[model samples]
Target: MPLSSAPISAPIARQGDGADPYAWLQARDEAEVLDYLKAENAWQEQQLADQAGLRETLFQEIKARILETDLSLPSPWGPYLYYTRTTAGDEYPRHYRCPRPVDGSHEADEAREQLLLDPNELADGGFLSLGAFSISPDHQRLAYSLDTSGEEVYRLFVKDLDSGQIHSLPFEDCDGSMTWANDSQTLFFAELDDTHRPYKLYRHRLGEEAAHEVFCEPDGRFFLSCLRSSSERQLILQLGSKTTGEVWVLDAEQPQQPFTCLAPRVEGHEYDVDHGLLEGVWTWFIRSNQDGINFALYHAPQTDHSVPTRADWQPLVAHSDTVMLDGVTFNARAITLSLREGGLPVIEVRPQGLPAYRVQLPDAAYSLYVQDSLEFDSDRIRLRYQSLNRPAQVRQLLLDSGEQRVLKQTPVLGEFDADAYVSQRLWATAADGTQVPISLVMRRDRQGLPAPLYLYGYGAYGASLDPWFSHARLSLLDRGVAFAIAHVRGGGELGEAWYRAGKQEHKHNTFDDFIACAEHLIAQGVTRAEQLVISGGSAGGLLIGAVLNQRPELFKAAIAEVPFVDVLNTMLDPDLPLTVTEYDEWGNPQEPEVHARIKGYAPYENVRAQAYPATLVIAGYNDSRVQYWEAAKWVAKLRTHKTDDNLLLLKTELDAGHGGMSGRYQGLRDVALEYGFVFKVLGLAL
Candidate 1:
């Protein structure tokens, strides 16, 4: 294959203009930008052509380790037991349901299974994602949304379960979230604006030709979403921005009535609402951050169905300086709280007449995600748990007796033993004397020996990089490579204070914290500088790009997937998706001080003449969140400035978006390609 001989030139900037040379790349739909992306894709393919066989082998190994034919535990909803299953070689799962047995058994009758939706069939050989899957109150119709372009714009569809017929709603450019009224015939959904922001709400009745506009959020900074209350009594509309938000509620029985505001939007204050039966009285569980950064739980009676302000809320769970209240789940008998403290997640159960108790886990560093409680009157709460070495295990907790039972642990086929891997929690001191936690996993046989290490991180939007099990990562561990996660200050690992120290004017802390963690690993004799590879995607990709620019010698190789490298330019343009709403996160660039601060650390703006490490950058053509041009422009700038002969490659998925490929097999293949690149760079390729 012949490579382009055109010299990569830097875009000229006029005096005091602060203009970017590669800004032309933002015209994603233009011919010049498309041609450049295609050329970059071809160049990457040719560069890695020798590793084609290795990629295939890796893909096969990953596929073989996964259980091809599997069924999820049936969850009771109304009169049916619903579950999803996948067949051998199928790209997607098929959702099915069966009538609950008269004896109230958990098992569903296989002979009477009713298929709700099969994504493979719905795709019809095209890209299709099920964004929202909702069943009507009567269970006679299923309302779902599909996004075929991978751009996040969804089309609503309704299926008659009993008649075996499908109806396509006329709504377009929806955000793919819908709520059904108590009547079951009326549905509420949110629509996206021209900038891909969900700002409007609509109501459509069954068999209606048009949907009526219910509410519109005039402010561009706020987004809207609709949800049905767990009690099935109210239709709630949530309006939110990065830091402040408000909620509105409508009587489910009166679908035509206007929504009433629960509380006015107050800057820097955030709250979320969920309804439940508390002490024989219908109550609203409101999680608010007004009193403390970690958030506090408050409850109020549902009197006269009037919206209560913060003044009327009574404290249930006081704010704790050490523990962050992640979320709350409610049922008739008790409430389950997802709390994070000391960089680990814990489930606290508060029964009606008993003191709160925390669920015990076996791992030092692990993740616990609260699953949806399908039935509001049940005495059990379900959660999924996983750690660095253990696969995901679903467990059910009996509220009354405080007994917990493991429902299932994902099966990993072939010669895989969890006991062979060791998981550890270590701390790295940052530049400002902050102790950053690092979760590490490695093969027990290779412990205490210097080996290649893959460090992963994402430190933005208060998202924690928790310990998770990955069968694909097993390939690296088996090859004497260790994996670790840097719980830096930008994430919510240590609560709100940690995240506050890493965003806005303090954004540089994220990059500094990541570098400190990398240096700590080297100083502790865990891995040498030449054997370290760092990886992250999206905002995390920003982390990788920043650290690489600051200390390229500390890492041997780097992988950035759909990276948001052109931060200054992107933040300057409010028209871009997520730019306006993210003002509270990265700070509004319109302000002089914020602009100067962001420009100082923006990866694309910071690229300079230096010896860079081997790098692989991946992009999705239709990614709406972090535009593909950011990666394209960053790579172009890096190539123009970096003085290294080390391999630098950019591969764009023309048919995908931010999430990459949609299907299971395709996703695995993408991972294999990434792993193959890492292996080649490390001289471990077969």
Candidate 2:
């Protein structure tokens, strides 16, 4: 009985409907759970078309055991220019003939006719051409951002990858990510206004007729902005959230001024601007709230008036419990430091302040990144390893004597063996005693009979899910299934008290730490509860719909990708657009006591019928952030209050959005149809 002390089943919990604190979890609220999810959305879309025909017959028997096993899905971008999909006299039988990054020279087949074009001619001219480009230093011009749907918004175009001509962008809620300036003719991005919120920060000067506001984000608070630079008229901002922040500098030719903080609004601080020299010497990174006496690399030195002067700073590396920094490549006489320290990832260097030569990394979850440098003198170094049966290896090294030089290798499955599968990481405990962390992976030959498991988690925004290594999760651990991952709770890996014990009013401690990491792998013997299943996508699909509505007898199947189970009508809609920046990570559900603690985990208003398991949800009709009709009305009211014969699949996709697939063999055929519904609900046989 040690697996997180299990024991909550009083009809899925109860006891406090007042003294407020989430009515101490008495349950049933929010306009009677949005009127029982609007009266079971049309009988769960008619039993989700027979659970999508048993997930397309377990994805054509795992694509016929991955086409009778030869297992070669590589792709880390090495073996320059290689892609093959032909059937002899191919008269267009599912065509695939890509080939371009060659250098076996003789002018490498005319540099593959000037770098292989055709992304369907930029999607037949309506735009999507990011097919060829590279400029961003001080050259000014090179941009691309498309996704016409997934909830419709991202559009930015701009291209001059040396006069090719495009220049789109007409203004719309850009929603996060974009950076380039050092005279790359300005570009920085972030948009939201029209009351969808997140104040603008635009810029577009290749011809410009419109594109202003260099910063706004305020209305009712929420800012997680990001942008970086060191030249082209200075810039380096980070804004806040995820527990306080603030560190400005902006100046792109002073666009209305007011943004010179350089680290102040602190509150459980967190900074990082890394490289330096817009006005001179810089290299940031802080963590403080005090504990491990952080600062794993700092340097400042700009002075005069841009802030940052702790006597012109300089710390450069400190560790305890582990550093793990990874980034900060500078070099005029040394500064390398990639980090990860004691679990692998090396490359120390330092110089001028001493400390040198480290290197390591034969593989322990690897990565290097410093690509190219000469005048500033750093000399190559991209690396990027992969294990759990190797798949992505990307090379470049050279760094004085690491010598490797591959380039790209992602076959995306040509055959599959991945060292016959095997991985581990363990550390369970959950149900209050805390400690969770799993990892798993499978098929190293084990008769753990009911072998199907799947498990996964996201908890909430603090995002942690680490222990990287995958070839599309070795095509589901080469079939016999297994996968794991948990690390539960408002992640941040055991830091800020495991993300304040899992967010807002301690969000049911992230669904009781993902059911005590799936009953600690069915009590450590490995897999059981009818061979579990569980899965997560988007807030880990609202942590697998809050553990299938508070544990429906453990599991036998589930997946919720793109899930947020209409959490109390999406935090009581603040005119939806990332719902008022997720009211400080899920809370303000129009307050009647945070709408009675978000309708006690609104998995489409908690469907009942007792024994409900077999599921599959997917969604993405251009997901405007979890809204494929809230996983199509929670698989239409869990197939109208499911009781037994459970099975409620739903696919949707409808031309992707919210990252469903954008190349790479259509996201491995939608992750081999969600691992063929976790090997046909644990019956396993692919």
Distance (Å) between predicted and true CA of 683, model 1? 1.2
Error of 1 at 226 (Å): 1.0
Candidate 2 lDDT trough over 10 residues, lowest sum: 1-10
Question: Model 1 over residues 1-686: C-alpha lDDT tens digits?
Answer: 12352324322111222467777777668776777777787778778888899999999999999999999989998899999999988889999999998898779789999999999998876677889899998999999999988899999989999998999898788999988998989999999987789999999998779899999998888999999887888888898987897999888999999999988899889998988888989998889998999999999989884777778999999999999999888889988889999998888999998888989989899989787575989988788999999999999889877798998899999999998999999999999998999999999999887889999999998998889999899999999999999998789998899999999989999999999999999999999999999999999999999999999999999999999999988889988888888898999889999999998898999999998999999998989998898998888888888898888889888888899889988899999998998898888735
What lDDT would each prediction earn against the true structure?
Answer: 0.89, 0.58
Clashing pairs in 1: 11-21
TM-scores for the candidates? 0.97, 0.31
Give me the runs in candidate 2 sitting further than 4 Å from their true place. 1-239, 248-271, 274-301, 304-384, 388-417, 421-479, 482-532, 536-541, 546-555, 558-584, 591-601, 614-686
Best by lDDT: 1
Prediction 2 TM-score vs. true: 0.31
Per-residue lDDT over 543-656 for candidate 2, one digit per residue giving the tens place of the 0 to 100 score: 788788888788888888778887887677676556766777777877788788878777767777778788877766556677666776566556656778766666666566
- Estimate candidate 1's alpha-carbon lDDT, on a 0 to 1 scale: 0.89
Evaluated at residue 396, the lDDT of candidate 1 is 86
